[model samples]
Target: MQGSSIAVDKIATELWAAEVIPRVKDAVVYLDDHMAEALHWNRGLAWLLDSGALAVRELSYFESGLSKAEEKAVFIVGEPLVGPCLSRIAAVVRASCFTCCTVITSCPPAAHHSALYGAVPQQELRDSFLHVEEQLLDWMGNMNFSTTVIYAPLALVSVAPNFVIMPQFQDVFPTLPAPQNTNDSCNKELGALPRHLQTSIQSLVGNLCSIMNMLNVKPDVFSLGQTSHFIGEELERCSRSSRKERGLTLVLVDRTMDMAGALTSACDSVMDRVVRVLPPFTKGHSIDVQVDMSSLCAASRSTAESGISNSVAPGCLSHRDSEIAMHHLVTAKQKECLMELNRLLVEWGSRNGLRLDVGGRLTPQLLQKRVNQFRGTSRNVLQGGLLQQVLGVARALSHPGAAKLQDQYGAEKLLLQNAVANGGSPVVQLLRSRHSMGLSLEDVIVLLTLLYSLVGEKALGDDECLLKAEIVQAVYQAAEKDELPLFLHDLLRENVHEENAVLAAVDHMFDVLPGLGSTADTPKHRLLLECSNSGTQPAVYKPLTQQLLHEILQDDPTLQLVHHAGGLTDRIKSGFGFFRAAAKPHPRDNPVIMLFIVGGVTASEAKLAFDVVSSNKINKQVIVGGTALAKPQEQLRLLFQRQFR
Candidate 1:
């Protein structure tokens, strides 16, 4: 799998350098705090403006910076939100003494205008737009500075937006990309959009096309999964050369295509460990992490093989030393420094005829002496100082409480896997028993939803139905206790009902269709199963879309099958001429396969696409991208908010 972090960072950096930076002088870059964290915007902007020219500040500081500056350029980079701070900043920018100002926003023109004016009627929206434009023009009438507004839409389809600020469930639907030839009204949301939420999605599509054009690679085949017709259509419209070349394949799918994967919490992976331990770590970027020294020390001591005394002086290292230690520990390059420090510590202990322990501490003066000696030579001093800090944090994360939570997650995963693989009364019985897995109500709901997706309503027996009802009631009650919106319970119930209906319809079609029923026993079906879940714990727990891409690319199968859950299957089949015949058998020719998830994709999914190609397989390449990378909790919260709020 490819590391999307690098790709996104590179893209953002390239875009900024090529487009945003050169146009301005003495610019103050105002970054959305959340976007800064999500896209590592600060790092990208800094790298692009290498001459220490970029004054990177939080969006909150825009007004303050405006107040302090005169005849300087101000660049506001963020989503359009009409909060008091943003309104004040907008007003101030119009009146500021900035010579050359630029507003590079992620939001599309329509969404930006809506945020400024608030949602209003069509006539009112125009009036508001004119009013804001007039206000800005009047304010800047006498100013010498030139102002530029750039809508740098981030049409991020393969990856979810911010997990912290999740979209509502209504916003999760696939959005039809606005036609390039369409008028400005195409961007506006004057009435309830008959298709999908165009606000964020339109910008997302536009940005995606921009990125694709920038890269100069045209795809050969575009296989869109169910409900992803809109994105596929947009890609087709934008990338004419890709369609003509017909060498690269692009697959677009929705989140609901693999709902089970999205809802299930991952276990036993580096990514999972990071997600579990580092709550504040957003999008794999290191932030200012708050460490509880006492708790960490206690946890470390308890887990240590030979318990070392905690008699070390509290102020052994100065506050500066502590901060430096933390920086060394968290920074990526310091891994080598840490290793060298470990080797040196072992050597020192051996030379001094002193026993070295994991929890052992040395006096401040001794540690400082060692650090000072290695200050110019090696990073050992800093590493040694931070050893406790790192070890303590790791140990604390491995505490019994965390272990129990993992155990619960594991149990839930096991049950779901078994339910999918071996569907019978036993799984239903287990589901019915509240204490069988010792899982929480939410976990049960997730498992139940997965089961519903796997086994159709017609296939489910009375016992399973009863168990489903019981679980639903339990989840509803639990939500009430937690003060969560009651609609969340209803949403889950609705999801189960929808899944049942869809699966039942699929089953019916298979039964009625002549060749489809028999095809289930073929190797193609087996391949789909392998891609979805390789019948292994790691595969099952990992992102399904990623695992599928990995297997398809690694095995280099002559015939590749792409499965989607929505109505776009026919559209994809029709668009891709190779799969035109509905009853045709798998082709023996080695063909590139594409898989896409529509609603959102996890980080794991994005990684697999990059990883698969890096293997340098001949004619074996997989392209994976998604709308977003949303967490289970975030998705659930969005669903709740969509239904209730």
Candidate 2:
């Protein structure tokens, strides 16, 4: 279940609906204001374009020759329109089918993307941006039609009610600033951002400040991870209003600092498992996956009316429908999805005059069994077409293949937790026999990255650290001896370079996994290695995000009052004190706790925010925002500098 407050995603979509879309309509109306017979608005809703006499006559001027065509406005959303996107825009602009066209974007124009992150944008990047712009401009100028492009201050996409992402920068990692020089800095280096990234961070800070200002809420800021100091500098530049008694706390963390959280698979999460198992159907910046819904539609009994046609044709799910369905699926837990699906099937069966009973209660397993038994009869076709793929998914979860996959993930997590100090043999065997272990090169790379993040480069000299070194050496050997995947070799060549260079880059690969953990007793192998050989307590392993949430509870000054209240009698006495004192109101009666990851946040990590909020801890809303909702493969690709497909 979700929290009482609006989810981050709903807020974002509503922002577009209430702000961006309305502005586009206003612009259209403003342009038509001077016309003698302008297009009329229907019920003050700009989304519906009404073609007047003048608008219809205007269509004849074009070579399209649609004298009776009704004028419509086509609004496009997406940033930095690429070559194929530009061509599509050109076609729409040239067509007489639509009277007006507008492109609404949140990001900097395509030409500026490279410059925002790099000292100098590559020649290819500049040329590509220019080529796209030139083609669009050529088409617009030749047509002589009125087309407008509006740049909005909208970069955040709320993927769910409480989760936000900037899809454009999904692959971007904040550049590490030059380390501050100091006598004792050999062991611990301070990180800084590049000049371009400084500008980008400042811009982000400015936007955040503006939002805070608009909301009339002063914020207490906490910065952590690799880009902490850089973000702090940007925040310092912005003037803040006086702090209030009750105000929200903003936690900004760099995702790279939590390599373990980003890499680990969440077995209990249905959305996590689906994203992991299913190959994502990527189209430009959108990440989606296909799912069969033939029997699902029949069970819901709304097939024809829904108009969800795909390449599979009638009784099949469409691409757009699949995206919407998956979005809903990811927002809920695995058990919830199965329960709901089973209920729908049972209800539909009763309504359709088919008396279906799986022990008088339809469960996912029993339904799956029945579906298999009824695989190809006329009755099966009439009753529910084909078996619902989701049911098959439920069944597959208990299969040996899924069990083996879970075991592999568990082993990887355990090995990473101990920094391979608990016998690196298992890791070596996994890397050497990856094909049998159901591990890909990317998966092995993730384990290595996590291992490196935990132990870091400094520990390679220690005898215990030699175990991890051997594991790394094994990976290198595996790559050389075995046949590589189509792109794995290229990825290794471009990013890894030589074995020693890669060993050096290990520190840069992932920011040292923060020493923070669920408990002090847990052996945090990384921290102990920093000093010249001192006995430091190991950190108890837990999700970095959960640890962060607990730290927030302990650190927030406002929360301290509620958490440290003496007793019920003391509180009542204070409430009835001579000052006519009432209990201090929690800022906004439970202000939003926004945890924004600087680089990218993973779906598994996002679940932690929901957990904190759902538990009613501190009675506050916890919202997670990031550059992207990263998958393990995406994380690997980002570190290795490969084009994510």
Candidate 3:
């Protein structure tokens, strides 16, 4: 935490700027052309408003700079523009007096409804698109305003560096039919992955290949899901080429595979911890949390040279800025976050002509005393920087009870240790005294999952199973009574009244953990899982993606693809291999691994992918994507849907 810097290599940064951002820009470029400005979606709207091509009588609270335009030529750029969004836009436009409006959306009709895209046949999907379009046209035709709708398909949204998500396919898991003959109690069998899901992942892999300019190399696919073999097959089908080298390692994981990791607290990640304490403002694919940027804004105003008093807003941080900060903050370790914040504050104070070197450690009282020394921008020279934004983020992360959450995390760790020592009897004790322990029911559930994972169901007797049932029933009651967290409350509640499903999901994590070499007694694994009290994140809590990549690299550091035995003609006839070549072995320099989670991936997992690629152990890179980027609670709820019903 106190080194030159905590080094992290992010290949997604280059991949996004070079490949993903261009696709996004191209999708919305027509809006720029229409407005005759080289600005993005929101910026283009702002420019049009300034130039009189568009107008908004009322300021929109949700959107930054400008809301959906109520007047002429309102271009809405978003993935999967569904009925609700369209209806809202239509309502707003009808309320206005505009004669004509052009509604340019970033998704087509079929793609607008994600379930329609992922669950139906191609012909049916196309027909549904037509039907939706016809209905939309009719709705607009009857309205007061004449509207022209434009559909521009944008299948992927780059949420963070090296992390992309399909906003339309958030519930990819629930849309697919559960395997037949599987019990409602718990079904963890490998079923045929849905074709639409396969095709979607295939398309994504192709995009990555095309963007990276990979040659005739087949991908080394490692599928880690009950139904992810189809995804690997699809990728392998598309990646058949004449190139002799295995270009990349593509890992397809089902989110259901590791329910324990998803359900647990990501104490290492600052964003995960902060989001748990403070609710984020979620709009479309963007998530923004509250922050106190008042001081930062004040500093900005003091340093503005344009003579405009309102150069910066003084309240909440903007969505764009907040997300950007989140990306960096989420990736940083907790101590790293604190260290960086301290550095930024010291730098800001120095620029503002305040001597704030109080024995090299920044304290709350001393920091406040130094802030009081700033009087009317006396000797303030340098322009305001990211200090305010970072300050806001820091304040939000360290909000009231945030420290207590960390303490609670430690307590949970101790509970797990106690359970491990006493053969998971501590969980039963906690169940009896959960309120006295001050543990949330969610945490209790997570503890049960970890206990089951460490000590198998065989070790957990009838009493433990009943304890699980009691916990699940309590959770159901809390959810019914509207006492559960908002994320849990909104989970797709099917016939998920079975305790066996929860235990099955936890056992599934154990089944996969051994394959990833995490169960082995290697020094690295030992050090990783060892206890730590040095104010650093515990090493045991790695993102599953990172662990999978590590195991893959450990076995074959180069990550070469295993070639098919069939010749080129046979492969072509089978239609599973794309490019089978007889060229010399192509040397892979700094290979890339693409990890795609079928259901959804958490921010912590995505951040860990970045860290693994950036690590010096293996010279490689990773890009992680999923059907949707979700929180731990959201993932747990989704897990319940897949496992039970």
Candidate 4:
């Protein structure tokens, strides 16, 4: 043979201070690349190269930090995870289940054997999270494999209707590869991540998916394709021969199907932040989310204006302006929401070790102004945006990913219920008031206008301008009651319309909601939010009372005897059908501000929820949350059911 060269995965490099290389007191001549290369070129020169750098990533963690290509970091699996000892010169990657600690080390021998290998399966485990196939755990308790790393993103795999048929986790583990961006929505932009970390995650997720798919039933074409274990093992052998320092990442998911953990009732808790706060159209770093309402109409008049630079609008000037105003309002609210969340984070950081950026804090006076601006902007985004035309986006997203599982009709029914329950436009509630009755023309107009404003447009109703300011003041007066979401249902219903008089609320609602829209061409979607017994969550993803509003709306919007109340005729005759008007906060209910974080949540649904929740400016709510606020199913199950199964 003429020549052959084998390249190792690891390479040593020098560290520079400013631009200068520092002198070492003591050093091992592990690598002399020139000689190594020369030896490769000529086997006769091999004796000239004495040694090379250590391949132990763990050892590198203890040595001073080196250029990324220089040091290998070790993987740790223990408490105080990534602690000072691990973080200090040694670069360490730790893999762990957030809802657990010391998985293999926690239990005693006999008990551990029974729990891990015994025939008895934990009820809660099967009910709350996904069940672990007997074969997968066999590798763990049986020690068939050493230091196995499970790689499938838990959220994806955990969502099957039945576990008895789902592929085993072990079959998915060994071939584990890193997660990849299957599409724009997957959010896995490789270049966006640090090089080393990127490869690690990709390998982890890819391997898992590959192995899992090789078994029983293959994933759907529209779904994440699985990788095989044989391929995984081959790759492993190559890596070992190359003496690669393999680090690991383990992602745990619990929510599988939308039905079992219906996330629909989370409008106040989740969705609003996404539409208004996240603004998918936006790009780059700064929150320069300025949208000129006047330009919106121009975009629609001419297709040239509808391009990316224009952002939105493809119709009449007024409609365009309306949409633009919606964007402007949403942007304004995001800043304010950011301010509010920053305040909470700062306090939390003070209590803990996290020191949030000082600039994010809002003073008491500025806070008041920010709140007003945010609420005003939110009102616009809700009323003018595409979602406003297509009603129930809030209800749909609030339950993250629920709309996907159900058929269109099923989805519509769910949304209709949600609209009604949230004290939907007067039209919906009115129609719902009497099972056989329908809304009058005037009622429909008012209802549509209300729905528009609720999405993100300027409301033309009683809560406008100074009236709104007064209502806000009144809300503060009875702040305690506002948090009691149940009491706010009537207010949410009546004021939603009353808040926007000029917009012809009911018609606008039809324009936006899927079933009510003018065209069959518009793809229809509905939400079927359900939580299964196995999703190891401690409580509902949101407050129980918040969810009840949609239930109430879908049930009945009338109190019969009264002209508007949703009950019977006798009560209406006695003014029972009428509800007391209280645009301003009263002692029974006050406006509330909430904070949500979805940092731990893995699904795009969770990230989108964060974006939606961060944009709310509703009368009774000033909530903020996103990916960071999402509580994992495991955490919920632990808190709700001891998470022991």
lDDT of 1 by residue, 513-600 (tens): 2211122223332312423554554223334455445555555454344422223555566567555446432211124444556565
TM-score for candidate 4: 0.20
lDDT of 2 by residue, 1-645 (tens): 133343444443344455444534322221211010111101122232332222212111222324324343433333345334444455555554444555554433322453334332322232334444445446645455455564443455544456666654554464332333423232232122344344355445544554555345655566565454445444433424345444555677766566666666654455556545543332233333333344444344224432233533232111211233334345556667666555555554565554555564444466565544433445544334223334434544544545555866776655554453432334455566777767666566666655555555422323534545654565466567664333345445655437765465343333322221211113322212233222243233466566667556545443321221223554576766734555543323346777777777776677765776566456667777776666766676564542111
lDDT of 3 by residue, 403-449 (tens): 65666667656655554444445666666666676666666655655
Instruction: List model 4 lDDT by residue over 105-195, tens digit each.
Output: 1111222222233322222121111122222234223333222121121111111010000111111111112223223232233233333
Using all chains and alpha carbons, the TM-scores for the candidates as numbered come to 0.59, 0.61, 0.64, 0.20
Taking all chains together, the TM-score of candidate 1 against the true structure is 0.59
Residue clash pairs of candidate 3: 216-243, 240-578, 240-579, 241-579
> How much is 619 displaced in model 4, in angstroms?
49
| Model 4: CA > 4 A from native | 1-160, 163-211, 214-645
lDDT of 2: 0.47
Q: Flag regions of model 1 displaced more than 4 Å.
A: 1-9, 23-25, 38-57, 60-73, 78-99, 107-135, 139-145, 153-196, 241-248, 266-268, 282-405, 417-438, 458-596, 606-624, 638-645
Prediction 1 global C-alpha lDDT: 0.42
- Model 2, position 522, has a per-residue lDDT of 30
